[model samples]
Target chain A: MGYFLRVNILETILIYVVIPAAIFGVAALLTLVPGRAKSRPKYHSGDSWDYPAHWWSGDNPVAVGSIPDASNDVTFGGARGTW
Target chain B: MAHGEVVASTPLAADWQEPASGPLGDAALPLTAAQLELLDDVIFEAERITGLRYSVYLGDLGTDTRNMAEGLVKGLGADGPYTVLLAVSPGQKVVEVVTGAEAAQRVSDRSARLAVLSVVAACADGDISGALVNGVRMLADQAGTLPERTNW
Candidate 1:
């Protein structure tokens, strides 16, 4: 009975811990794919998960003749100065 | 009628809450007036459409989602009821959406992540405001604050 109980405890740990860890490991490995991969930042641990850059280049919602230059908005409004 | 007694006029001041300015009254969270203005616009537009306090920040932090999780704790300047931080860097396209303690309880990480992802996607497409608006919609949807029908 003692041996059976130990075996059950081991099984529980394997079921709850090991499996999830393995799944996460696999998921992390999958991140290396070209489109799926995250961008590398020097000295920063965080990776930039990229999407299609310049998703709306054609329409140009903010016209070139608008009050403020649309291109300036991208640099000033969105771009982070720190990074 | 020639008393020559002058009466002092008392001016009535309007009781209104003026928007606070400068570093948001917190040293830890550094932000400029322009940045605050942008965030205020986002919040105003978002609240008008979704009724949520949309706060954004720009700062450096750790890697992975963990950094954002940690940021959720220290996003806002003042210790308010709730705050959300959507940090973005165009050069790297690195974005992180961090929700405060109170906000975390109300907004799940997955949903918040989705919202951020949506915005990131939009930024990639070159629609900053559109991205933010879409992201706000996602958050509203997650919080069930979005209208039931598409009419609204």
Candidate 2:
């Protein structure tokens, strides 16, 4: 009877305490681990144009003019002074 | 009492609440989708007409707007000469037009000033997108005729 009681108490502790603690510990560790689910920057409507990666890339829907060649005599005309 | 009744008696209310004037409430980018599209179209059209690259930067320029504008123009790489960069800081009420050497030859300072005036006028009326469109068109018009292709 004493042995049976001891075994029953051990079984209750395992099922009620140990299992729940282990489950919670694993859950907390998983939450702390990096690269699980990363968040991205929120984009506004005009963000595509503001971001150089989007604007300069071919992915931009708007067709921007071609970049000039180095050999070209690129004049710095218009208003040289900043406003 | 039962366990369910004890749990139900607990209060879930918090002592603190988020302020109404938060970042989420602020307008990060003022322009709408259609307005951005309009500005893009205007810029592309200006580029096509002048045979030069046209780019618009709308943001804060810190204290020295001119230096910042110049740096932005210079950073255009090989396209700098054939590029016309319009930097507008609406908050500061400043507009700077930086042209590459090639673009400057066609679009004069006087023309740029005139374009600025048009943009300022439109801005005063609360039409930022319209201002950009009109400004680009005016700048392109003032850029004069594209050089003739001798090889053709």
Which structure among the candidates has the greatest DockQ?
Answer: 2
Residue lDDT tens for model 1, A1-83: 78777678779899899999999999999787755112322222234433222111011111111122221121111111121
What DockQ number belongs to candidate 2?
0.10
Every candidate's lDDT: 0.46, 0.64
lDDT of 2 at A46: 29
TM-score of chain A of 2: 0.39
Which one wins on TM-score?
2
* Pairs with backbone N, CA or C atoms under 3 Å apart (clashes), candidate 1: A45-B63, A46-B63, A54-B124, A55-B124, A55-B125, A56-B125
TM-score of each: 0.38, 0.55
Q: Give the poorly placed runs of model 1, Cα more than 4 Å off.
A: A1-83, B1-42, B45-52, B58-81, B146-152
- Quickly count the clashes in candidate 1: 6
Cα-based lDDT at residue A34, candidate 2: 63
The CAPRI-style docking tier of model 1 reads incorrect
- Candidate 2 lDDT over residue span A4-48, tens digit each: 777887798999999999999999998887651233234322233
